[model samples]
Structure formats: structure tokens, C-alpha cells
Target: MTQDSRPRSPLAMVLLALLAEEPMHAYRMQRLIKTRRKDDVVNVARSNSVYQAIERLLRDGLIEVREKLAADTGPARIVYALTDDGRAALNRWMDAALATPAREFPEFRAVLAVVAITGPDLVADRLAERAEALAATLDVAEREERTSREWGLPRVLLLEHEHLVAVTRAELTWVRGVVDDLRSGALTWDTEEMLASRPPE
Candidate 1:
């Protein structure tokens, strides 16, 4: 899918990811996403979108903005903290994000579409590549967690990091099986049979 077709904003993900931690300043949040967090390794993509995401979150009331007098900047700065409502929403999103893939049903629809497409081998290859990428992403997160733990991030933060890594790994496992099945002739298409099975439509 094109970038536009992707989630219009990583705002939701960004807010939830930050709220996953305690309150932080905008610059700190930006640094957290963009700057090297651990020994020049493991960085979250810190584009201007991170700023935009925070703005949207403030407008949405997902995160409350507190204006504070700053000592270093010589001006008031806004700090963001997750609201109760935000936390509730975060809980819901986390549950959905971490749950098994089929829970979304799109995976199944994609499976059907893969079978529907010609050159199933190519699809299987793509799926395997996707699985590898997903695993690598999760591994990077694991490394981040390890680094963060050593740096003495809050206990809760470390725990959540562990859970997030586990969820990513679980998704990788699911994708691996999907790749295997696609390559193993576990699914197939029979256009004529499907046409016959269909009703008038």
C-alpha cells in the first residue's frame, strides 16, 4: 500500500507508545523517537510526524498538555501526560495490537486473496520475507529493552517493553506459519469450482 493508504497518522501508535511510559516533554518525546536511545543503536523513526502526532493527541484529549515555566528554555513549555481516558484507550489498543493476527480477520482475507492471486510461489516468498522483517523488528525491540533495562528505565517500562517484544515475536511466529502454509500447498484455488459453488452472484 502507498504511504497515504497506510494509517494516516502513527499518532495513535505514538500516543499509546509514549503513554506506555510516564509523562514527558515534547522535546524528550521527539528525542525518544528519533535520537539514538542506547549507545548509538535502536532509534524510533523521529520525523516531523512525531511532533504532529503529539499535537493531534493534545487536540484529541488523549493526552493532556500542561504548560510549565522552564528553567533552561527561558519560556513556557508543554508537557504531555496520558489521561485516564487515554490509558483506557491504550489498554484497548494494546489488547488488539498484541492479540493473534486472525483476530483482525484481515489476515484471513489476505490469505484468501493470496490464494486468489496467481503465482502463489511468489506470494509465499513475499510472505517469508515479511516474516523475516517482522522478526528482525522484534529483535531490535528486544535489544532496546535490554539496553533500557541496563540504563535503569522504570520497572514498569521494562515490563511493558518485554510484553511488546513478546507480542512482536508472536506475530512473527504466525507469519512464519502463514509463509510455510502458502508454500506447502495447504491452500489452493479452483476458479471453476468456486464459480459453481457461488450462487447467482
Candidate 2:
């Protein structure tokens, strides 16, 4: 099977995750996702986002859109099914991300990509920017979540912002390590001979 085009957004990930099981239409997906989010006050997901994700996935060749047979509700709907490449990529991304506790983050892998090339100063700068951006977004999300009326929220979820905080700190610590490496001149750019002869993991 061909390797699939990588997906970046959470909605893209969610789409692939769901489509791995079976084909689904936009309407059913919206319903299931709404139920999953436990949002009852207002729709956390929009029809446009769902349709846009579908279009993007189709464009990326991760999903195939099939014309559904006529049903009681409306016009012929498009059912999305995962291609062979989609299945393979979804499994690969999941295995890589969920492998081990500390070794399982996509964000860390992304940082490592830069660290392997640009040394530490740039990595630290980028991490600082990211941390600040994520913090501000999280603050807004928390405030909105609290003031908004939503039904069937998890009892403990109201106080679960700690997870985001912890992850942010972990990333910051990694960034600090990168900065220290740069300051101490510990990063070696000469790695071709090392990698060319390295053994398999």
C-alpha cells in the first residue's frame, strides 16, 4: 500500500480514527462526535468543519467519498471510507504516538526534528513561542468552558486543566535542555559517520 499523506489537525486525526473502523457520513459523524464530547448546550462541532475536513481528507486521498443510496432524510449523501493508505498511516501514527509514555508525543518528535538540525538556540526560541501560544489558548478555552453551559460534562473534567499544564512544563523542560546544550557547546554537528554505522534499534 502507498504511504498516506499525513494529517495535522485534531479533526483530521479524529476523522481517520473513526474511519478506520467503518465508513460513515457527515451527519452520523457529527452526532457521534457531539455525543463523545458530551456537549449538550451548544454544538462544539460545526457542519462546515466536518464537511471541510471531509473535503481535505478526500483531497489528501486518505478518504474516498461514495455516493450513498437515497434515504428518508435528504439527497444522496457522501459516505467516507478509509483507503488502504489511510489505514496504514493511521496505524503507523497511532503506534508511534502511543508506544511508550515518555517516547510517545508527536510534539516531541517535531521538536526533535528541529533539534537534530538547527541545534538548540532556535529550538528553545520556537519552544518558548509555542508554550506562550498554547498557554494563552488554554486560558481562553478554560474561561469559555467554565462560563458556557454544557450538559453531561465529566465530573472531574472541570478541573482537568492540569494535564495541559503538565505537558506544557514537560515541553519547556525539554526546551531548556536544548538551550543548555547550545550554551555549553555540547551539540555536535558531525553525525554523518555516527549515523551511517549505527546499528538498528
Candidate 3:
């Protein structure tokens, strides 16, 4: 595939990885992702998302249809397997992902950059809500990790879950601290004065 046409998104990488294991139909791939709780890391909420990624992979020559099996009660199932190029691409993507941090622009960070416009009270209230949500998410991830261990899953399989829990807990703590600072007037800002101080072009 040409550089411009290379499939490099998280979904594309995941679809290739799934094919690396064994040739499977699109429906089975989607089922496996959900069953393994990979949906948290990959966006497969829409059924069409998986098929769309498959199409891109096929177009890029990263994967090919191995066979089509007729079903007794539905459309034929087309099983896909990874191409040689795909295996190379998967390894390359993994290496780059693990060895470097890509610059990402998360919405929360963007909002924080200009948050002073929202005034202290509103920002504090919203961040407080976000902290609650983060706490709940962290709790769920911790529970899931414990359950996975109890079920005898290997540590390698739970690495992502562990990372997620750690990140969520850290975010929750930071957000709570910011909210406390705002409420206690430790982080106050004069919106009118700041806006008035802006330099004219």
C-alpha cells in the first residue's frame, strides 16, 4: 500500500491482529472483540464500523478473503486472513506505538486550554462531574481486572486493563484536586479583567 493509503488507525490495527490469529468472518471478529472487552480500546460500537475497516484493509491489500461459507439461515460468511504485508505492518505499528508517544489532541485538553472563558463556578462544577464519572469508570475497570484474574486469565491479556485503571485513577485524583481549588477560591480568575487585557491586533 502507498503511504497515503496505509491503514494505521487503531481499528485497522486491531482488525489485522484479529486476522493474524485465524481467518474468521466479520461477525465473529466483532463478537470476539466484545467478548475480550477490546471495545474499550477499539471503537466497535456500530456494527458497520468493523465492515468498514475490513473494506479498507482489503483495499490496501493487507487482508484477503480466505473463503465464503454458505449459512443455513443467513447470508454467506466471508472469512478473511491477513496478507504477508499485513503481518509486517502489524509488527511495525506495534513497535512504533510502544516506543513512541504520538501527539494526541483529546477534547478535554482543548477545553482546558480556553476554560477561563467559562468562569470558575461552571468549570469547577463540570470538572466535579467529570471526576465522579472517572471514579465510576476506574471502579469498573478494577472490578473487571479482578474478575479476569479470578478466572485465571494471563497477565499479558490484562495489561491494557491495568493501564486503563491507572490512568483513570490518576485523572480522577487530579480533577478532584482542581475542583477543590476552584471551590476554595485557590484557583479563581477574573474573566472580565482577563478578556479586557487582551492585546488588540
Best by lDDT: 3
List candidate 2 segments past 4 Å from native: 1-6, 38-44, 99-201
lDDT of each: 0.65, 0.64, 0.89
What is the lDDT, from 0 to 100, of the residue 123 in candidate 2? 59
lDDT per residue (tens digit) for residues 87-141 in model 3 = 9888888777776676689999999998877699999999999998998999888
User: lDDT of candidate 3 vs native?
Assistant: 0.89
Candidate 1 local lDDT, 76-192, one digit each (tens):
667778987677666665555455332244574577554543455776787788888888889899888888888987876466567678877988888788777877789545655
Q: What TM-score do all the candidates reach, one by one? A: 0.51, 0.45, 0.93
Residue pairs in clash, model 3 = none
Residue-level lDDT for 35 in candidate 3: 90
Instruction: Write down the lDDT that model 1 would get.
Output: 0.65
Clashing residue pairs, backbone N/CA/C < 3 A, model 2: none
> What is the Cα-based TM-score of model 3?
0.93
Q: Could you give candidate 2's per-residue lDDT for residues 1-201 as a string of tens digits? A: 122323345577677877887898887877777865533322345658878877887987878976576778868777889998777767766564455333236775775664554535565567667667766766666565555435656656554344555565566566556656756778555355555655788
Candidate 3 all-Cα RMSD: 2.2
In TM-score terms, candidate 1 sits at 0.51
- Ranked by TM-score from best down, the candidates are 3, 1, 2
